[model samples]
Target: MKFPAPLVRLWHRLGSPRWFFETTAPWLPWLLGLGVALLGAGAFWGLALAPADYLQGNSFRIIYVHVPSAILAQSCYMLMGSCGVVLLVWRMKLADMVLEAAAPIGASFTALALATGAVWGKPTWGTWWAWDARVTSMLILLFLYLGIMGLRQALQRPEAAGRACAILAIVGLVNIPIIKYSVDWWLTLHQPSTFKLTEKPAMPPSMWIPLLLSVLGFYALFIWSVLQSTRVVVLERERRTQWVQNFVAAEGSKA
Candidate 1:
């Protein structure tokens, strides 16, 4: 079967590691700048400018951090799962690098979500931790991330490790929906999401706008971190190649 021209072009473009590196290199600075700017703006606006929650008061400021971290954690897992699929089906090396690069970032965000959730819980729930369905599921998600990272590290051959990690990542996708819907699916201390696509937001625009910005900023940060890490992976993986040798030599001469 013949694929469409555009689809074939896109497939080849994305599958090429050198092309991916060259194309993304120029955008990294811009991505970092945008991420930092939006995050700084959102932090100031949400933590100081936005009105306090009627009941939660200043403690509610934690949402700015907690919500974004949790959202990114889940989204990152989805990205990893998609990359795993591409690696397994298309045998794309770039997909493997992406999957590996995303693991630690996803894990970090998951850890942040748990930490901030615990901190937020202290004042709201009068406890540091609880086995609420959402919380427990999120913890499981973190473990899944760690498991993938461990699996990758354990294998000596790159191809074997990539395949193993890809399978693990694809399988772990089952937990994402559980984490997302756990609040609705079970009796839990965690409240429902503040932002919903189908209805008006739970909070006023003044509050939700900054939150929206925070989410965007966090997403940008995730992309930037992944790109930076992927570049390192590319360099290491391609170190024996002529292009990498020339690139290293150029950098050395500049230094």
Candidate 2:
């Protein structure tokens, strides 16, 4: 049997957690800096400087924060599931760290998404909560995150926990599309995306500039945070190893 070269290479790399850590750690600080700068700029420009919506007025500004967070929330889970699938198929330890690193961050994003959505809903829809398809689906997504985190912690064996979380993540992926297309698929109260902002963003540079930057900023932040947390997860999982102890001791001596 011939093994695909790329897949074989990926599987080999995935087998080593230390390699993944060393490869990704150097990028985290740079990504963090870029994320903060772009996100701050986008939030300020979109929320304060951009002209109010003609229909909804000033209240619509919340979308600048809400929409981005919500979008990231759904996308992050998909990324997690994709990582899980890769881990299970390739038998990669790094894949498990990726999943653990993402769980809390994804859950936090989901919470932020739901919170911001409710706040936006109150002003636009005249209600804070709704039984609408979109809202329900988002709520379910939040639970799915909680479940994955919970399942991971509940299991004793590292491999068993990782496998269980992977399965749960894959099964819960059914809700991603439901959240994405809820507005289109149902007669829900949630509004669809529009093409305008700031006296109607007349050009792509005007509107999409921030949109793209904000999305990238969010993704960068997600990756940076995941890398930082994955370091912790790796340390915890490998605490008995000599490397982690020596690394911690070296840091302490420096301090």
Candidate 3:
């Protein structure tokens, strides 16, 4: 199957470490600024302006943070899984760099989700922890992230470590669906998805609007974080190369 010329060019460029670094460098500050602005707006709106939930009251406002974190957690893993496939099949260096860069960020997001979920749960469920399917699966997701990082560091050879971590990432892709469907598949304290693309949101625009902003903000920040991390990995791995040496010299001169 033939892909479009533009898409093919994009795919190849994305695989190039030098191209990736140079292309993304100018966008980092913009992305960071936009993410911060949107997140701040959404947080203030949700915490102070949005109406309280009749049942959960002010506590439900935490969804602004919790939902975005959980969504990014899964989304980041999916990205790693895609990179894993690319690394295994095409042996793209950028993919390996991405795997190294994104694992810790993904894990941090997962931890934040779990922590916020616990805080939200205390008032709603009257417990800080539970063995509920969705919660348990999310915990497993965190471990999966940790396991991938550990495996990568454990191997003596960089090539072997990248291959092993890629395989593990591919294997762990199965858990994403389980996490998504757990609330529906079994009885759990967790509620069904609050927003759906096909269906209208159960909450009013005043409520969902801030959530939308927060989700977009989280995504922007996630991209910025991953790109920044990947750039560091690229520099570290390519330090001996002329391009990297020149790049470092240029940066040092600016400093």
Candidate 4:
């Protein structure tokens, strides 16, 4: 069957905030529900059912949280950079909406990565913190997330906030590669990267599969949260506009 080209064009055309909001609202409930369900299931399987590592013992279970959080932290920044690219190219409010929504979340993930890593480190590496290149690069990532958020706050106007934050986000993205390679580049104290999804692992899928599900669950939650935050931001930014006032009044009238 041949798909209609115009339909595809129309679909892409409607990816803006207004179209996205209207179209995606119905799916939000399911997205959030599935995210929660998967998170619980994955957590149980990874933390309780999975066998302890031969060397690390039960201590390795920390990977259930630490690995997912660390992966999300880096992935979130990459996603943020993609949003910045959209903002630069499309000049659309929705793109800015994504970045604005993502700032706090990305920061929280970075914090989680650092905190969970510290917890895992105490047993495995014998220290809570260190100045190794990998550790320092992750620290820099935390600060970069903070920097983007700060830029957003420093500017009151939406346009100013978006542009400033976008710049910071772009600059900060340069650190992602450095973070990924720091262990190899500088012989850092941090453990070498072992979870390359493309590569075969020494461990069997029975263990890593559940962990991967947990990562996907965290990602879904992050996406849902960012969309929610972006919606709120759009409303606040457009509050004084006629559409927003009418929209609010209509909702309030319904209530």
Candidate 5:
């Protein structure tokens, strides 16, 4: 099927590593600065200004970090899975680079979620860890990330490695839904979602507002990290190309 002219043009441009690198060059600093500012502002508002929960009190404040990390972790995986589809079906090289760039970021966020969950759990659940469905599924998501990274390292061929990693990312997508609905699907100690699209948040405006800022910050940072990483990957992979050599020479001359 033929796509609209603009969309097709955009797709072709997006697929070009050189185009992507130059296009995103000016975006990196802006994204990083915005992310840092939003995060810092949100952290202060949540920790110092937002009213403490009557029940969990100060402990509930951890949601500022935990919730955003958990949300971003899943979102990152879903992105990787989409990239996997693009790589496998269209053989888009940038999609593979994005998938590889996202893996470690997703893994790090997943680990942060697990760590903060444990910290939140210790006081609330009286345990550091549990076999709760949501928790276990999240752990599996982290493993899937590690597995992709390991698979990439194990393969000597870049094409082979990208293909293998793409397949794994696509397959591991099953765990995302499982993580999302695990609390409702089975008996577990984990609480239901704090925010839902169909319902008002369980939190008041004071709480949810700061949380929202933090979530936005996390997303901004995710984009910044992916773009920056992809840029480096583009340079490394295209080092033999004229553009990359020119870029390097320009930088060297500036220095």
Candidate 6:
């Protein structure tokens, strides 16, 4: 089937490693700067400026980090799954690179979410671990990420590795909804979200504002990390190409 003109153009543009690398290179520093600034500001405001919870007290501050990390972790998996679909259906090289680059980052964020959750739990729930629906699903998500990374490493051929990882990523998409609604669907120790798009947040503006900043900052950081890693992947994968060789030589000359 024929795609719309704009989508077709976008697909081709994204598939070209050289174009992607060059296009994103100039934006990297700006992206990093914005990410750092937002994150720093959010940290300060959330940890210091936002009033403590009447019930949870100072412990509520952990949400500034935990919520953002959890949100980003789920988003990263969705991103990888989307790339997996593109790689499988369209056989796009850039899609494969994106999927590969995203796995470890997703894993890191998932791990952070779990770690922070455990830390928060120690105070709130009086335990470090629980097999609650949300926590269990999130743990499964982390394992899925590790599985994809491991599958790619185990495969010898690039195409084989990409296909294997893509399949796993696609299958793992099921867990996203589970993670999101686990609290509603099952009796769990984890609390429901304080902020919802369709409704006013349970939190006051001062608290939710910093949480919003944290979310945006985490997303920016995720984008920056993915772009940086994708650039390196592109270079290594395309090292045999004349463009990459010339690019390397140009850099070497500068050094």
Residue 243's lDDT in candidate 4: 74
Compose the digit string of candidate 6's lDDT tens values, residues 1-255: 878999989778987999999999999998889999998999999999999987778988999999999889889999999999999999999999988898899999999999998998777666788665667778878888899999999999988899888888888896667655764476434444432212334899899999999889998999999999999999999999999999999999999
* Residue-level error in angstroms, candidate 4, position 156: 2.2
lDDT of 4: 0.77
Model 5 regions lying over 4 Å from their true place: 178-201
Regions more than 4 Å wrong, model 6:
1-4, 175-201
lDDT of each: 0.87, 0.78, 0.88, 0.77, 0.87, 0.87
In candidate 4, what are the lDDT values of residues 130-165, reduced to their tens digit?
555546677888888988888888888889889777
- The TM-scores, one per candidate, come to 0.91, 0.85, 0.91, 0.85, 0.90, 0.90
Please state the error at residue 251 of candidate 1 in Å: 1.3
For residue 241, give model 3's deviation from the true position in Å. Answer: 0.6
RMSD of 3: 3.8
In model 4, what lDDT does residue 145 have?
90
Q: In order, how many clashes per candidate? A: 0, 0, 0, 0, 0, 0
Checking candidate 5 for backbone clashes, the offending pairs are none
Over 3-74, each residue of candidate 5 has an lDDT whose tens digit, in order, gives: 899998999898899999999989989999999999998899999999987767798889899999999998
What is the Cα-based lDDT of residue 215 in candidate 2?
Answer: 74
**Candidate 2 lDDT over residue span 125-178, tens digit each:** 777876556676778889889999999989989899998888888877865675
Give me the candidate number with maximum lDDT. 3
Model 3 over residues 1-255: C-alpha lDDT tens digits? 999999999998987799998999899999999999999999999999999987678998999999999999989999999999999999998999999999999999999999998888888777788655657678889999999999988997878888899999998897667655764466434444432112333899999999999999999999999999999999998898899999989989999
Model 6 lDDT, residue 165, Cα? 89
Residue pairs that clash (backbone atoms under 3 angstroms), model 2? none
